[model samples]
Target chain A: MRNVAVRNLCCGVLLVAVLALAVWAGWVAWERYRAANRPLFHEIGWPDLVPAGWTPPDVLRGMNVNRYQDGDPEAIDALARMKNAWADAPAVKALDGRLVRIAGYVIPLDRENDEVHEFLLLPYFGACIHVPPPPSNQIIYVRSKAPLEGMMTMDTFWVDGTLQVSTTDSPWGQAGYTLQAYDTQHYEVPAQSNKS
Target chain B: MPGILSLALRSAWNRRTTLAFIVAAMVLATILLLSVTQARRSLHESFSQAVNGTDLIVGARGSNVQLLLYAVFHIGDATQNMSWASAQKLARHPAVAWSIPLSLGDSHRGFPVLATSQAYFEHLQVGHGELLQFSQGRMFNDVYDAVIGSEVAQRLGYAVGQRITLTHGAVAMPGAAHADKPFRVVGVLAPTGTPVDRTVHITLAGMEAIHLDWQAGAPLPGMHISAEAARRFDLTPKTITAQLLGLKRRSDVFAMQRAVADEAAEPLMGVLPGVTLDQLWELAGRGEQVLMGLAWVVAVAGIAGMVATLLASLQARRRELAILRAVGAGPWEILALLGLEGLGVTLAGMLLGVLLTASLLPLMSAWLEVHYGISLAGLSLDVTSVTMLALLLAGGVLGSLIPGVCAWRMSLSEGLAPRV
Candidate 1:
């Protein structure tokens, strides 16, 4: 009788302890999942997307970006975390028609055939066709008419315009950063080289 | 306490097989975890270094992802080439610093051929701002000269002056090779652990000359020009697929992007390499989390093994438990002894595992540097790893109590007249 009672107690304790452990693990996993699902960037209303007259501060930090490359679509999961802070962006926008400034390169500049005069803008610095593209560097589609002269080769350009969110996904469309341009202007200014 | 630990070591030495099994488990777990971490680090290093030290990249006005894939990694071919006029206009910006044109349409044995200038080696930066260096020969200067990366050189067994043909598009199966304009190997770059290691770099004129006779990737029926005779045609590339740009003033990147878009030159898009690299990093975070989860599983497995072993050995330790009780050792003392044994075994295994990791790190570093480009010099225990070890030790001790209870019961049953 004593042996049977002891066996029963062992079974009962093991079952309860294991179940408790499982429940605790499940709770931890649930919290982790919840944390992952939470949005990282708080999007302002449409009007708040653009900060009107932002320029390079007294201390300008030059970030290298490859404009010809595309954004990494594999990171579509964390579009929210790519802030100007994390992604060197001016502002994070999940939609289009918002105004923002972007900078990058002009890969294969086409001046003759023009439905839209636009350039591929990178956030950092590089243009290599045979390498994988970075995700934060987005394609800036510009709507312009007149062809400007003397902007040749792979030169960095600052482009200011409104962000037009792409509705459809293209082979080039990836997650993180994407903005089309409207009312775009080019700036070629003398930069104080600190070798940042 | 030192004497007790020495005694414990002696006991472990006596049961070397059992101890060895535990150590083996620990080593395997460590290797698996470490291997995954190394792979993640190297993969990211390779990826980010793919387009490093670049101010901007410009490509076709298609999907940004498509542009990136074809332009940088050479994974796919660009659907179409952008106009040279547009590239020229964007390059002339006053804020412009350095620029390189990349023409991609041809391939050689499934490897994409990049038509670029000699400035590629001088300006191209990768892996924490390291520039490309030639391991074998000099950079390409002539029209028929080519520069290949380290892996390409090794894989193809290509040497200086060895002739090679460029193919059209990414052809895996039998495809047409550009027999007309065979290129001679000029230089081979040392491994940078970047995508450049897989490419064959050539002059832009060579790319144009190779396709002079071929129309739409087919032979122009009997219109063949030998590499010697191909110099008659103007070899200047009409259009390139992509371009890299640097700024005289870094502030002009956005302006250049806008000028290319607004300056009636071309319909294009510019992107930042750093921003996109962060995106890739985010994509790999989940893999990191998954590996960490597996590491936790191994830890749990080790704990369960300790518990099972302690419980299994209780019968053999029954007499010891009775002897302790006879000599005024209480139930708590029995518990403490068994707990100490468990802790000792786990601690030993963990220490040995850590030592092995440290010793093997240099060899691993050498292999990774030569092959995968990961700097594994900092393989010492981090806070998280230390915490894991501590948790394993504590859990092992606590888990032995299950068997310790059995010993307590045995002592109660035997009392002073316990049998060995």
Candidate 2:
């Protein structure tokens, strides 16, 4: 009778060990599932950054800017005016301090070794050079909590952060929008193309 | 289980000579893999720590990478020097908070000599805004005073009062020495683990004082200005190699770069140090990847050898395993015995490999610091390293199981009557 009782006890311990392992594995799988189904931050698009019913100031309205010759005074004056207007571009105040995820091209500002600690995010590629910089509202100055590695200029990334609609002096004189990013992931185009 | 393990240990000892070779191979493979990773990491860290807190590097129009290498790292020569007038203009620009002008093309005992202002000591930073600190004395107070880096002082056995002469060019040519204007070592910098530790610093006025009578890379035929008399003349610098700028606002960097490009006085280029450094890494990244891949291949070969050695020994152990089966041991016991031997060998190799790597790091770091001015951090078991070790362990155990299974089948078939 004692031998039978010891055998039962051994079997019970083995069963408990196996069940504990299974429970731990199940918990890990469930956490992965939840993470995949629901992202940490709400994904936002470039259009959502601009406030509803707000439009850019048309500096060259009814004037054909291309017709002017190079070094023309009138054209230079118009260009200066347009740049000034863009520099003072308005930002959507409601989105201030909101935790969100947005994707854009990177223009690194500061680096420590191979990692970038600060950068500017633009909605399009080659926005900082060859073409005039976008309006202040369109630029997002990002300060990463942890330095980002293997990131280069113009690399597209989906950055998650708290977006602030504050206007600070920029290369363009004055710009709005800053992000304190907690996470940054390389951006990839979705395979599905329903709208197209 | 203890009995099986003891049997396994004794069996392994019987083939100790053969197993030792396998362990040595594993040791070498582990060292190769970990050293390569460590070297790559430290190289990047040392290069980036050379310069920090500076917003822009402006130089004469040329390759951006070349400009950064020469100005920040003192690694290469500049194609042309920007006029001092242009540097002053940029310094006076509203957006610029401060500027440190750098004049190169001189050396002292193979160490590059940098001629800058007092601001360099105040504003220049290394390794995350770490300011330059003096170990011996203060900044140069006179045109003939100089400051030496830690490595320069230690290697040359120089002190605060030691007097040193500068060479006109990067190499120490026969007649290029400025023997007439020997500088008094006013200060010695603390160790920074960057190129600064291998440099010699002097004031711009001192650099000008030495070259007052020299023109077009050579001293004039008849003019000889004594060090004291040379200072009496206007010691203003005409040109400089490059200038490091700090902007009032971080956002004004792009604008400053554009403004520097548009300067009407001369053709100058401004580059973001971080961006250029990234480009440099991208250029060298392919070579680094090839080296890492080679290390992995060597590790795989070492693990394969371990498997082959165990499998070859299995035939000789057939009779022994058969006897154990005849005596009261089961097939499972025989299998566990072989597996335990394999685990024990691999575990020993890994531990020894780690110890060897840790011991060699300081020696390797010293060599690199003397040759390349790059300092390496001590051995650290970060997540990546731990993960790699875990994967290697798994691979080793999985490889050993193959021989164990084969031995189990052999013992089951040939019990008590082994194939001699």
Q: Model 1, residue B67: displacement in angstroms?
A: 3.2
Query: A45-128, model 1: which lDDT tens digit per residue?
Result: 322433346332422234233322344543321222322222342433444555455555643223321112434554344533
Supply candidate 1's per-residue lDDT for B169.
Answer: 73
lDDT of 2 by residue, B219-312 (tens): 9879999988987899899999999999866656665776687577899989888778778989999999999899889888989999999999
Off by over 4 Å in 1: A1-196, B1-19, B76-79, B105-111, B155-157, B263-265, B323-337, B351-420
> Model 2 — interface RMS deviation?
5.6
> Could you tell me the lDDT of residue B288 within candidate 2?
96
DockQ of 1: 0.03
Worst 10 residues of 1 chain B by lDDT: B369-378
lDDT score at residue A132, model 1, on the 0-100 scale? 28
Residue B373's C-alpha lDDT in candidate 1? 29
How much native contact recovery, as a fraction, does model 1 achieve?
0.00
Candidate 1, position A90, lDDT: 44
